[model samples]
Target: MIAAMLKVMVLGVCRDRGALAMAFVLPPLIFVVFAAIFSGTSGTEMRLKVAVVDEVRSDETTRLMDAIANEPSLRMHALANQSQQSLREAVAYGNADVGLIIAGALTQDGEQSPIVIVADAGRSMAGPILSGHVQRLIASQLPGVALRRLIPSVDMLSGGLTSQQRAQLISSTDEMNTADNSKSITVGESGAGLFRMEVLDGRGNVTVSYYAGAVAVMFLLFSAMQGAASLIEERSSGIMDRLAVGAAGTDVVVASKFLFLTLQGLLQVGLIFVIAWIVYDVALLPHLMPWLATTVFASAAAAGLALFMASACTSRQQANTISSFLVLVASAVGGSMVPRFMMPPWLQDIGWLTPNAWAIEAYQGALWRGENTWALLTFLWPLALVAVVSLLCAFALSRYRLRLG
Candidate 1:
């Protein structure tokens, strides 16, 4: 009996390609993606698109522009003839990462003018990136002056003039004569102050709100997969054929399964946010309506995807293997496991194809960005559409599979 069972087990393994792929192929692929996500930042280059409106038109202002242009990381976009307001708008709407305006003369009678740096709060890195360039330029020209004020979260930084604002004191010293070239760096505070959440990690900092959405979407896929696996179970137990004989037919069976999975997914996702709120202090209650709307659409999408996967596979093992592999791949590419921002431009574009990306984006908008109904719809609609399409495809595929069986 033992020898016969061993023979049967070996034969089963040989027949199931999905099991072989899951055991041997999928693990390495997942490992590769995880490795890339963790170490990829070291190889990734940080590039900032800088929008500039040079109203000063002075030699000193020209020097400042040149200094900015010389930074390897800064890509200067001179918006010649554009107004300062236009520069600010570009950054506000994300057309530009950082906005720079040089208004008035750079210096008059040894008094330096301020260079305003306009940046969006959502792009927190841009502010520091631009500021670092300015700091380097200042150090190169005005050696002894210190950064007077540094504010991280606030929208604006005032370059309030002090009696010793200029590097004139340094100019008095022959070893470091940069007093005359001292310039004040003022940040333009008019950009939209979008809500941002930061979570510290030993490895690095993460946007807590963004990851909250990502993690929710990731687990949602798993929940939907688990719920839809009932289809495979029913088929194995000869229940699917019996259900197909009912009044509403297999269509009702599929719809009921989809509905059940969707509700289950919603509950799973809700619990995720509850944990986020309790532990991470994420503000969800204030935007509960839109958050619920986003969750409904996201859950529907996951449910549809799960049904589609269930219909496409031949057996329980195959469905499990395929669904798990595809879900993990989608999560990795869709900013669930790794941020879309951290991905290469090509991969970022590819991420848009996944429902996970849209779901996460919707959650981010509703939960943290304070986007209203219409704005939330922009992301949610795509997910709803995907859910509809996937359900249709799953229905058709299930019919075909039933006929074959």
Candidate 2:
């Protein structure tokens, strides 16, 4: 009996093309996507976009900027004619991951540090990562500058250095700088005091807000897909035919399902965020209006996508397998499972196509970043359009199925 049942199960799965693909093909594909995304996150291969403002424009700062531009880990853009404010705006609006301002001479003594790193609060890691790169460059490419800065501290601590000692130190630094550029020399000291960090839109733990939005959209997609699976059951049981022939019609059936799924998704998002507020203190109430708008559009998009998937699938098993594959893949690529910044440039560009990306961005902007109405709309409109197009497609597919039946 065990052998017979095993054969029966295997035959059933083999006969279903969707199930076969889901069982055999989905795992490797998902593994590949995840590998490509996560393998570069260890700082060696991660490429960060850096916007630079050279206010001093001195020879030392110019050398520093050129070294940064040549770095493999950083994609540096020089804002030659732009101000530090422009660089800040670039980081704020996502034009660059982080901003650098060389406000003074590298070796100059002043009340403020010569370097400034501007970063967004949500992507808090970017600031530190860029800081590390800058420090590394200063130590390796600009050893003279590093040595000059160190001399002041040394003089302060030791009372003074003789002219001969200072001259010898300066000669060593110059020789190190003029040495083979390929080999990097380690400086025991850190460049922490050489730069100040300016974090933008920091409000009540932006990391918590990011995860709240990410989890909300991901579970919303899953819940909406599960709820929409009822269409497959109804069709299989002849209820779809009865409803199609009645005064209500199949259109009403699909529309009603879409509405219910949308409402279900909205409730799911609300509950998740309420917990986030209670436990994580994610600043939900302050931006309630835009939050609500983003929630509604996100829910509608999930519902429409779910309906379209359900309408196209012929069986519950197929729908389940396919929906799971798609939702997981989309969530991974969409910055829900991991921050998109951690992914390589190509994968990050692909994330923009997923609804999870837009929903997360909109929610983060509305709640954490305190973005204006216009900025919020840029993220919201894509979700609204997805809802409209998917709903129309699902409706047409359902009507076609009704005619065939």
Candidate 3:
């Protein structure tokens, strides 16, 4: 009897192809995505987008900029004829992960450092990584600059080098600069001190603002999916058939569901942000208008996606399983689970396909970065497009494909 029951279970499991795929296929696929996202976090394989401005334009600055531009791990955008303000804007607007401004001579003058690293507080990790690369480049590519800067302090401390010592020191410095010392020299923390970091939009709680948007979009997708699953239940129970023939036909049912789910998502996101505001001081009240606009579009997109998933699936279980897989994958790639900058270049590019990325960016722009109306539109339109396209697709699948009435 036990063996017969076991056989029945095995056969039943094998017959359900969706369950089988969900149990076996999805784990490995999710592992691959997680591995791809986390594999480069150890700094060796990580790549950063750097926006550079050379204000000094001297030989040293040119050499340093050239070295940085050639670095394999960094994508450098040299903003020629641009100011430090432009670089700051680039970083603030997510055009670059970090900004580099060669504002003074490479050799330190008094207490001021020459290199400036401008970063958005939301992406705080990028600033230090860029600084490390700059320090390494200065030590390797222009060892003479390091040696020249050190010599002045040494001379002042040692009561000045004698004429003969000075001559020999000059010759040795030139030799050190000309020789291949890439493998021999290492820049320490003191060398890294040559960089000054200027972080933007750090007054508010940056982490809360960023992850609030992330969690909001993710849960919006999930809640919307759960609510939309009722369509499948209604279809199976003959409720949809009954509604199809009534004065309020299938169109009304679908439209009403869409409206309810959208509003539900909006309220859900509002509750999350309201808590964020009360607890973390996330500047919600200050940016209420743009924030509301972003929330509405994001909710509509979630509703549309959920409806489409429901309309396409034949069973509630299948819809749940598939929606879970898709939502998890989308959240992982779309800067919800992790910042998009942390992912590789390919994954970062793919993130644009997910509504989470657009919604998160729109919210961040509205709350954290204080982006202007025109700039916020760039992130808004994609979300609106997703909502429209998905809603249309859901309508078509329900009306024509399913033939409900």
- Clash totals for all models, in order? 1, 0, 0
TM, every model: 0.70, 0.92, 0.94
Count backbone clashes in candidate 2.
0
Candidate 3 structure quality by residue, lDDT tens digits, 75-162: 9765644888878888988889999988888765567778889989999889988888887887888787677667666788999899
Candidate 1, run of 10 with poorest lDDT? 194-203
User: Which pairs clash (backbone N, Cα, C closer than 3 Å) in model 3?
Assistant: none
Which is superior by TM-score, 2 or 3? 3
> In model 3, which range of ten residues has the least summed lDDT?
184-193
Question: Which segments of model 2 are wrong by more than 4 Å?
Answer: 1-10, 77-81, 157-159, 164-168, 171-180
For 1-405, candidate 2 gives per-residue lDDT tens digits of 999999999998899798789888998998998888778676466788899998898877888988999998899755545798888877876668899998888877776888989999877689999998998998888877777778878877999999998888878877766565666655554572688888987567788889989988999899999999999898889999998878988889889998998888888999988988889888888888889999999999999999999999888888999899889989988999888877787878899999999999899888877775567999999999999899999899988887887
Question: Cα-based RMSD of the predictions, in order?
Answer: 8.6, 2.3, 2.0
Task: Give the best candidate by TM-score.
Answer: 3
Per-residue accuracy of model 1 over 160-187 as CA lDDT, tens digit each: 4344533433344323323465544432
